[model samples]
Target: MKKLRYVKDEGMNKKRWLRGGVAICLSAAVLSGCATGQDKQGSQKDLANSLKVMYSGSEDYFYQEFGMLFSAVYPNIELEVVNTLSLENTLLDQYNQDMNKALDAFIEQEQPDVVLLDPTTITSLIENGKLYNLDTYVAEESYNVGGFNPGLHDYMKDIGGGQVYAIPSTFRSQALFYNKDLFDQYGVPYPTDQMTWDEIVALANHFPTDGAPSDRIYGLEMAWSKELTEVVNVLATAEGLNYFNSDTMQMSIDTPAWESIVEQSNQVLTSDAIFYYDYIYSGDYEASSESSLGDPFLEGRLAMKLESNYYIDTIEIAQNNAQDPEDIVQQWDMVTAPVGLQNPDSTGYSMFYNLFAINAASTNKEAAWTFISYITGDEFARVQSKQSYGNIPLRAQYFDKGDGRNYAAFYKLKPINNVPAYHQVPQRFVYEFPSMLQQEFASISDGQLTIEHALSELQIKGNELLATEIMSQEELKLYLQEQQDVLGPGVITR
Candidate 1:
């Protein structure tokens, strides 16, 4: 029985790993190989008669449901989808061991026509030449690109090198979730879309300590994970510091922006307004004054938490599980992150989303492209919006069309305001910048390193990584030239 359990767990793990890996690998292999059925003498219809689509298991339902709609529009095509749902632990282990092999093997075997992938994963895969170029298809087809925010479209190009490699299906931005019940208890105004960081701090400071010194409420709870590093980047950029210059491939850390972040963090830490997790070693929040964001916020302990729009589903789940569901509903609400000086009244941030791309080497390129179009286009967006997919629709028109309950709730949630300057950085930079900033910033916040020491060390370590892991200037120039050749001239503007 023990052996049986181990075998079952192992099998489940393998299934999960294969789901993400196989889809990725198949998509990569298609970029390298010739289109399916091209060598066999046949008409366009014959070439597209049957095709296989490899997609992540998480996306299986979307493919099946929306896929039927696509077929209804064009019956000549047949899509056979393969689902792989690999365990997270297995993928992490593989990632540590170079991260490309399992995916490569899957691509070499299944040869799927279309694939959906996380944007960061796609960026790394693209760097290794594992995907197709979609320039020709995008140019020829009259896609409703106009509906997308121009900044987002431009950011996609910077990552895809003007090839339109993938279609942005959904997007997420970070926001501040506050407990309305706590505000009422403290007689504080609810945070607004236009609140500034200073204002947030002031609001946090107003919580009455009362006669008992130990009974103080914490103003904020921070997650401090690598994911929140984007918050740091946005804040830095808003303070007028450029962390990365994609044009010159230089990293600058010794700026006013960095200084501002360190100072602000210190203020938040030292202030009576907030109590961080590290402040209390006692894990029991009920026995202590401090709490982590998730626990405290859900239990009505903390006043505010910085979270992504994706947290809405989790919030809803927690609310459902509450002893009094009505109490949960009355307690929580989300607002955009505090505005910075540069973007005063606006949220300074960046976003990434899951996207669908066609296999460049598929024997059925046209059919695959058609399927991709249908999946990412208006019809699929509407259906996806209705399903509570923790995502906002990419198409502007679909925002108002879905069911009043789900879609309307999402619409009431504000769209994050972002600047063109914030969106211009390459996708690779966006992924790496956050973690690097977090590591260095955490050291400073923990008092393990001083501000100057942190900045200097960050520069040294960052340069070393850039020199070793990232392509050099000469290599990038050559790559850009090659991409221009495949995509035709003027696709990438300097």
Candidate 2:
């Protein structure tokens, strides 16, 4: 019997080692050679074969369990896994390489049969034509591609204008995870899936009270790190908002929609309904009040938190490692993140999703297809439902039977109708602008800037930066291709 391990942050892992699925107890070994398939009857004499897999910047448990599971099915194939710069977002960031000489390295180094890629990495590979189109293989196998959310398939094709380059195995989405005990203690019902942003904020209001001690529980706790941007990005995206207009290359932040997001967040922050760790721990939120703060949520000082699938393992690890069995943190579960007012039906956004793709350049396409097919299939879904890694499976069936983790709530509501393109722009100009927005949020917390002035200043400053950040199509294309290396002949330009 295998137990759960703490997962790293969600951005790096769509494979968010769930609490269920194949356990990683199998020596943490990877595929580097060939073997035979495992048989229920216990004979592998005829199933002898080989398959090589390459995955980078991921937990050893994923490969350990995956190797164990895949080997069991086709024990005859030697499952070799190459682990390298597997850092979640490092693939495209590997800009140090010229013309994607990285592909040159693959030819000289170990040529992997299958490459486990995140959306960004997969897109890069697709542009370089390093990936083989799985359409024919998918069709030949008549794979039940319908088990996943239709949007996933649509988004993958949309990226390449109808070519299936990568298969999505796991994804991360935001959810409202509440401390059930707190809700119960106050006789407040747990948050529902249909709750709107204001409704959830209203729910948060139920927690903090004047009579409570200085250690009075906070209403809601957001990770406070980068989530500020993520929350706003989700809202803005759902409303069809973008910081930079790709076509015009202009910045447009002075709008009512963006203002609503800032205002609502301001309301939540001021009302003490939301606790940002930095706003508190930085001695800022306490600049006015004698509020108690720390890793309040981890220390059991918070009643609720906004998180994505990535947070599951961290919380699980905390629960498992607590000094005393039941020191505090009552029962907790997640629900779909609240929807926006204007786009009340919008599903929130995730920074990235883990995608699995076959190496079109692999010599063993047949065996590679077998591996990719099985792992993304219902059979793997059945296997995944058995564990509680932080990552959520794309299949609905797994959610129906998953363990005690409340995995279903993560997907209880649909996500944004589409996956937004990975933003790769001038970090100094386009990206840093959001940080200014956060600063305004912080300023609002400090009473240093009025909300109106903050928005006005944000717009003015943003547009100034946009002038330098805008690029022509040729410039944008070059920017996208920077640091990219071709692993083989397969590449495409969007």
Candidate 3:
């Protein structure tokens, strides 16, 4: 067995953080040429090991999806899963309903061998030295890390302070899905990869916008949401704009760049070239069903749509179940998601939901590594590649959908930095800011306020919200006084 070193907690899993950083030592194991059950159980072939894993869903579901398959390969290992649903509920109650606090405590208490975490949670654990550095394990087992997406590996290394602490099972990315038949019919050229927002909007304007709501053929459709705010937010994020700066406790929404984006978004949203579903009329189920079951793109009424890889399955299902030849789309392909003008070569739409990590203090480290290695190995990718989970498998080679579509579009663009802006501020601000943005945009659309004025108001109100939520009375006074001295009086309302 290989011995590894980890941080020692002084109290009951309660320490500020490791000041000196984590300690890791190097070691190597003989390489396994094949990812077979016989090759993987080299050192532990004779011993029976029982392993516990922490999962988001129920144990039965995990077994049905993953555990069952894993057990079939390595029957010597017995698997048990601890569901996090009840754990989160109990922790939430104990920690005054503060989810971050609850999650911190949850990690300290639930010391399972293997656990699933989000990127932010993984970062927190890495900082606290609660996660084992997988560098040694990968080296000791001679695991091939090259098969996974290069971007996800880079992201993990960055967050883990140049040492790998976790590996993502799958990644979610957006792509530009266009109807080939619609483009040909409209005499418009097809959309291409790395096209900027301005270019996409220009392309969308080519189709004629002269017909009834149901009968109209829109040039562009955003399948995620029909709300204008969602569109603006997606566009702004692609441009690498951060709404709020947590360090300076400042808002960046009221800039000239933001005003320009608002204007462009308003023009595109109000134009007849785009399909903005009216939720008021959505009460009519029959009317909605006629419109590709709420997806205009599937009905061939849309020229292009921006959606995740999962939408492929939806389109495939629609095509198979079409009552008539025209009821569902027959021909469609995808390109990369729209790029930002600032960083045209990269995108921010790529993300991973399930990041697997091992506890630093687990007693069964060998068994845990075996499971992690098995799940992220070649055989696992080969098996999962056959199914459509609406996500890209880590090992891109095995990703075969049987059709030669542009599946590479999902991962063609290098990912822009994965630093989440929401993690910097209070969760309340993250939840509230979008609605606040929408309300101000509504005023602009109603002609009650200009774009510049709306953004200015948004900035001031956002500052006030942050002040009340993040600072004490005395601190707020000092902050406001400093702000007034820099700018002018009446900039920040009391």
User: Residue by residue across 356-468, what tens digits does model 2's lDDT show?
Assistant: 66766777877787777777777666566555555566676666534565666665554553332324334335435656777776776677987678778877776677565
Candidate 3 has its poorest 10 consecutive residues by lDDT at 22-31
The per-model lDDT (C-alpha) reads: 0.55, 0.58, 0.69
- Candidate ranking under TM-score, highest first, comes to 3, 2, 1
lDDT of 1 at 366: 77
TM-score of each: 0.59, 0.67, 0.79
Candidate 1 C-alpha error for residue 372, in Å: 1.7
lDDT of 1 by residue, 50-163 (tens): 767766654556443345555545556766875544412243234332335545545555677776665545555576666778767666546666665335566567667665
Model 1 spans with C-alpha error above 4 angstroms? 1-47, 52-76, 80-112, 115-151, 157-165, 184-187, 209-216, 225-251, 275-281, 287-294, 326-331, 343-350, 359-363, 396-450, 461-494
Q: After superposition, how far is residue 230 of candidate 3 from its true place, in Å?
A: 3.3
Error of 3 at 482 (Å): 34
On lDDT, the leading prediction is 3
RMSD of 2: 9.2
